[model samples]
Target: MGAPARKQRSGSRMGARLTVWASDHGRAAVGALGRLARSRVASIMTAGVLGIALALPAAFLLLLDNLERHAGDWDDGAQVSLFLQADVSPEDQAALAASLAERTSIRRTEVVSPDEALEEFQAVAGMDDALAFLDENPLPPLVIVYPVTGTPADEIEALTAEMGEHEAVDTARLDLEWVQRLQAIMELSRRAAWLVVILLAAAVIMVVGNTIRLAIENRREEIVVTKLIGGTNAFIRRPFLYEGAWYGIIGGVLATVLVEGGRLLLSGPLERLASLYQTGPLLTGLGLQGTLALWAAGIALGLCGSWLAVGRHLADIEPR
Candidate 1:
């Protein structure tokens, strides 16, 4: 045959072989799915375990995300209290508050006169009678400054320091201890979430691997016969790999359902609570991208687990 004809024939053979390979893979995948459906209860039980394992971490991370968002709201609520000099006049105090309020960093400011400050203290401390004994009020006028929401903590601190330096001011204090504590808590929660993710991911792999190993043993005789009849190792391994992939896909779907279901269950209570506080939604679930990523993770873990099981156990099944 001429060179061109021979090349064409070779190409046709390659294409034909590829088509057959693809067809076999399609059949193996469908067969694996059908086998699982035949044993519905056991398949569901295995998938359920994997679903729960995956869901736990996803739920925790979602909670953490909500918390961080709420904490940011708290950051906006933080206030700075400025104590005026004892001798500073009420007019000067009001003027200082007004000046502070005009600054871009300051959201607004309230001037509290000595009498108002003392009255508030007496009400809170229940020391009205004790304070009556003093000839003159000892409390200083106050300027309560609310920083613009979402202002950086460092900028807030600098603003506080600037307020304290004002001629009419005695001291400026920003109660940020609570904010610091919240930051520490968020950091700890993030680390804990990561740890849970790692542990649960491993558990999922082990679960799938053990299940695949059991399947390999149950089909040992069939595998031996196939090998004796000239089946390649890849051919024997294909169905099990598809089986593992199906398990992963199912588990991933189940996990998504569990997480979303929990979110739905909590949504009403959370919405009511947020309404009471006059805030928006307090919790959010994994959106489209996140759901896809979770499904991909499930498929990857399933494939890894099945590959490990097949690689180890398939080698031991011989035609002896």
Candidate 2:
């Protein structure tokens, strides 16, 4: 009799555990589904709004990235032209080119003879007829210098100044002003991209909050009955929070789709533009990390918006 009683007690404990587990999982699943059914139309509308909002900033960021890449190619190949005086001998010009090339900061240097320089100018300027009447070619020899990667602008400027002081060098000019302007523009675009993202996130939260507020108003009577039946505030809030989360997850997915679709739509025009400039293709889509961040941001906005709505309205519908 004692052994039978112990066996029955063990069976009862196992059954209790199973029942608790099943109840918890069933409630979670039903809460999610209930939230979905309660505001299907509102959820869809909010998701669409969020999708469009998120896509705008993402697309702008893609455009900025492509522009930066195109700018980078020109920056990496920054050049300086050293014009030698006509009195400087060819041997001295060659020696100057060799000396500059030997410097750690200088990547490569080439000296162009005076006659060759004249030919190049005439060909480029389309002024061969004007040049034929000259008694002698008046162009100076040139030393073209390429700086090493990651060279500082100040250092390059100093080097140019030093080169200009040389008796053999008539003029020295660094071609880096355009690069500086491009870098400034890229920085401005980056800041603007972030600002746009923040605004869009706020927009998403507002949309979700308004929709949840309407839901609470519609279910005011049900909430009152739950309070009378002894349901805790947490129990009443769980389904609404779950609903907000669902909206966020779905909205994130939709936003990503919109961003990708927009990229595809613009890719052809962008390619044509790049071809005109002889540049590599511009990067136009979010990377894995960016995509993940976007999804998480959407979900968080949805959850916070729903919480705000529930907190503001739930206490008003008491047992009375």
The per-model lDDT (C-alpha) reads 0.90, 0.83
lDDT of 1: 0.90
Residue-by-residue lDDT tens digits, candidate 1, 1-320: 89999999999999999999999999999999998999899999999988898889988998999899888889866899998889988888878888778898888998888899888899999987899999999888888999998787788898889878988888899977788788898999999999999999899989999999999999999999999999999999999999889988999999999999999999999999999999988998889987998899889888988999999999999997
lDDT of 2 by residue, 150-216 (tens): 6877888898998889888889999988777877888998998999889888888888888778878
Model 1 lDDT-worst window of ten:
91-100
My TM-score estimates for the predictions, one after another, are 0.85, 0.81
Q: In each prediction, how many residue pairs overlap at the backbone (N, C-alpha, C within less than 3 A)?
A: 0, 0
Candidate maximizing lDDT: 1
- What RMSD value applies to candidate 1? 3.1
Pairs of colliding residues, candidate 1: none
| Cα lDDT, model 1, residue 260 | 96
